[model samples]
Target: MKTSMAKQKKSKSLLRREWVKSMVQNRYLYLLMLPAIIYLVMISYRAMYGILLAFKDYNPKLGIMGSEWIGLKHFKNMFTDPYFRHVLLNTILISFGRIIFTFPFAIIIAIAFNELKQRHLKKTLQTIYTFPHFLSWVIVSGVIFNFLDYTGPVNSMVAAFGGERKVFLGDKKLITPILYITDIWKESGWKSIIYLAAITGINSELYEAAELDGAGRWGKIWHVTLPCIRGTILVMLTMRVGQVLNAGFDQIFNMSNTVVQSTIDILDTYVYRITFQQTPDFSYSTAVGLFKSVIGFTMVILVNKLSKKMEGTGILD
Candidate 1:
């Protein structure tokens, strides 16, 4: 007992000393972060109270606290709905497709940009690429419509080739792929910026040393370049997996019509349709959103755990 007590005392002393040292060294930094800490407490933590609606028959008239509880009814309704399956599938398919295609392209663009010796040309190209990221889905929709409508440039070109005018946007078979392709074209360049920053941070001496030892461009990239940026890639991938259920709601909603809604309807649109257009049940929508949040939060924990086991450095640690 005495030995154990002594060890405990020593540990307490060490912790207290470290805490004091940290407080002295970083008190100003902590003070600077105070506003952000308070903001998170007010916004993030306070907003969590809205989740109580998921368990209640929330009405604007009755208000949140006075609402009658009807636990799990909304969830049960969701499970029984036939359209839920389609929405769930669309969400997963679109999110996964983006992850698979977009990530590698970002990495490749970053690597290629790092290879360019002309600074002016490289900056100009990057600026051009980044321009599309600023365009909202509404603007993007207008641009897409102009090219895809019956009498648009595409149809004119097709007519010149002796082909019939095609309604690309309205076609169920084409809409999902077009959504994915257009999304990639719009966002990939901007997304590559972070990866390019990571690539630029890699030590030039490593590449020079490899070249000195007779390594080619491909050889250096395979060995040095990829390994250096793998951590950033892993973190980005884990974040994507955490959000695998959210598949560009604004983009989908703007681009989709009745013709392609079956193929492109996702959880957000489903919730919006149920809450606003059909049932107008605030509680049901809250329940659905809460369920989505739970699933996403759980997925982040599970994926982060697996990533820690595989890669040693997961998202958090």
Candidate 2:
């Protein structure tokens, strides 16, 4: 027993020494990662303590730690609230709508950009397309209001064209589609950068081989380009699936008004309204946020698993 214990102790000490040596060897790499590490620790990990507020009756005077524990009370209320159910349904619908409509635009745009032969023209077009992503939702909303408001250019054009003026923003049926369109317009170009990078990394030999096989541009794209970027697409898709619950809070909040509020009231907006617009219920709001997080986490795990099963690899892997 003594001999075995000594061997174990010596092994542990040797492993520690090796780990220290490896760390010293990669000191520069660690230095490069320091800012991200600090951000995760200070901004993300530190905020995790607030999650406890979901199970507590939070009071400003009492503080997070001092608050009375009311385990599952807020969760029970959330489950029973009809408005919450409606909000959840809306969130799911809008999120799926974006996945269906907005998600593919990035891939398509990336492919189109890759096909452009003129470098200067491609760069100019890419700059024009990606410029919208930098504009905040507040600015975008103002532009939308200017274009879609009553007596705006669109309405004026409709009037001139012998058609009735339309309240585009106020129309519930139009709002969801508008959201998808705006999201695609603003984000698709910037998001395409990833796929473009993936495409750049693809071996040119594959394309040459396809060309030799009498494969044209379309054939090369369908076979070589797409197959090469399939992993990146799957990884991106898995990450997007993880965010299934987040249906653009900033965009929805800025664009939504009383007329279309009910139709676009997602979980984030619902929490915001309950917490700030009406009577503040910190515990309930926290509970809602927690629920959203749990659902998102579950979605990520499930999708990652599905990706692994289908492709023999996953985001987590």
Candidate 3:
């Protein structure tokens, strides 16, 4: 025991010395990271104080700390409200829809990009595909409107093709598909970037070995490339599970109209509506937001457990 204690103390001392030396040597690197660190502390960490408002009956006059404690009244009300179930259902459906459709599409795109023989062609396609991700949702919505509006190009095309013009944008049945397809268009290309980078990190020797073993391109991708990048894919999926409640405020805000509101309204839009458009029930909104966050946190834990059971590798681990 004495010897083990002495060894532990020596190891800790060495760690402290190395930490000091690394800090002195990497001062410039730390300087580059300072702004991001400050923003996280100020904007993200500091804003966590508002979560307490979920448990309180907030009053602008009484302020945050001065408000009366209401326990789980807001949370109970949120769950019992008439539209709560529909909103919850919408959030779940949209979240899983993106995962099921968009996730595999990204992998396919990454593989397609990697298979390109011409350097110039690959670079051009990459840029073209990734450009839409940078455009704000508002801009993307306008572009969609041009295509899907009653008298828009799509409707004009239908008219020319001897079909009746349709209300594509306002159709309840079409709203979910439109949202999914447009999001896939804007994000799938960018999402593939990480997978592409993971593929790049794989050693060339594996491909060469697979080739020697008579594995074709698709065979190599299935047997070697995919196995190597499974870790990244698993991590991304686990993170995605945590965000099941967060069905993109910007896109939903821009795309939703009264006609499809019942089908498309989610936790985020519900929070926004109750906070600003309605009575500005700060407490209720905060409760709804908190409920979403708590579920998100729980989701990460559950997914991590499921991943470990299925893959023998938990994302958190």
Greater-lDDT candidate between 1 and 3? 3
Q: After superposition, how far is residue 98 of candidate 3 from its true place, in Å?
A: 0.7
Give the best candidate by lDDT. Answer: 2
Question: Tens-digit lDDT track for model 2 on 1-317?
Answer: 99999999999999999999999999999999999999999999889889999999999999999999999999999989999999999999999899999999999999999999999999999999999999999999999999888989999999999999989989989999999998998899999999999999999999999999999999999999999999889888888878989999999999999999999999999999999989899889999999999999999899989888878987786
TM-score of each: 0.83, 0.86, 0.83
lDDT of 1 at 69: 92
* Candidate 1 segments exceeding 4 Å error: 1-43
lDDT of each: 0.88, 0.94, 0.90
Q: What lDDT tens digits, residue by residue, belong to model 3 across residues 164-222?
A: 99987789998898889999999999999999999999999999999999999999999
TM-score of 2: 0.86
In TM-score terms, which candidate is top? 2
Residue 53 CA displacement from its true place in model 3, Å: 1.9
Q: Write the per-residue lDDT of candidate 1 for residues 163-257, one digit (tens) a residue.
A: 99989988988887798788878888998999988988999999999999899989899989999998888888888888898898989989989
Error of 3 at 115 (Å): 1.5
- Candidate 2 error regions (>4 Å): 2-43, 308-317
Which one wins by TM-score: 2 or 3?
Answer: 2
Candidate 3: give the clashing pairs.
none
